[model samples]
Target: MNRYAVIDIGGKQLRVEPGRFYDVRHFTSLQEISRSDVNIKVSINRVLLICHGSEISIGQPWLNDAVVKGRLLHPCFGKKIVIQKIHSKKKKRRSFGYREQLTRFVVDSICLNGRDLKDS
Candidate 1:
């Protein structure tokens, strides 16, 4: 069975699975850890939901006993977004591009009440 969870990070909600990589907005805490150049474990407590096998758990706002564990891989950038603007009969044109700073995170395990679902 596959195990997964919905977690909140950087004001955004993400559905993550174990052994997979995800790019999320850069966090100040992650920035501090990345400087050490070591394997740093990150625990997220804002778990909205969890699914393991045939069982499911939901939280009211967040589950206090549920936690998602992962590793901060590295810093990266999101896809570039191009913006263009033009004025009618004014011959005025403007263009811009933007890329959001992001961090790569790999989900290692999901724990509920001190029990890791990946082991089972």
Candidate 2:
């Protein structure tokens, strides 16, 4: 049997396992984050993974009984959306398209002391 760790991201819990991938929901849309007047840096780099017995730090390679590792692959796009505006009196129309941003990740491995943390 295999063990996994639970991680919290975007107000949700994710079950992380070695050699597996998980798609987390995006907190902010691409258009919203990109067009903000205020300058902000979107930190979508790494996540913390902890298991029942031990914890894993993202920077260093460390795994406990239930440890896992993952990396941010890329930002995925959602379905195409269109916004339209029309004026009856002037007979004018406007249209716009948009797509949401989604992220992808791949589990590296659960290791401790430079060794795989197999189920005990």
Candidate 3:
């Protein structure tokens, strides 16, 4: 079985595994930082749970001295969702759509117990 972690970001919980990319809610400042640098290291301290090999650690809210490292893969908008409205009397219709911007990240490592292991 592969190791994985459950992390909280922007009040949303996500299941993340190393070496995989995920599209998450966008942070405005992240775009500014990424503009200067193509890739940057991101450390998330809101790790709710970590499962490594046979070891498992759960936090009351968040574990102390524990973090998850990731690489920023860039920012992009997700698929659009459309909405439509119609007026029966006028026989008129309108349609619009919205797309959520997301930041892409690849979970690099999950650190616990004062040790680090790079994802394979």
Candidate with top TM-score is 1
Instruction: Give per-model TM-scores.
Output: 0.90, 0.44, 0.82
Model 2: CA > 4 A from native: 26-67, 79-98, 111-116
Model 2 root-mean-square deviation: 9.8
Clashing pairs in 2: none
Best by lDDT: 1
Model 1 residue 71 CA deviation (Å) reads 0.7
Which window of 10 residues has the lowest lDDT sum in candidate 2?
A: 36-45
When summed lDDT is taken over every stretch of 10 residues in candidate 3, the lowest stretch is: 26-35
The global C-alpha lDDT for each of the candidates, from Candidate 1 onward, is 0.86, 0.55, 0.81
**5-112 in candidate 1: lDDT tens per residue?**
999899899999999999998555644544456456789988999999889999998998998998888777899999999997999999999998888889999999
Residue 75's lDDT within candidate 1 is 72
Q: State each model's C-alpha RMSD to the native.
A: 1.8, 9.8, 2.6
Model 3 agreement with the true structure over 1-120: per-residue lDDT tens digits: 568889988679898998898998855345454445656778888889988777788989988878889888787689998999999999999999999877888988888867885544
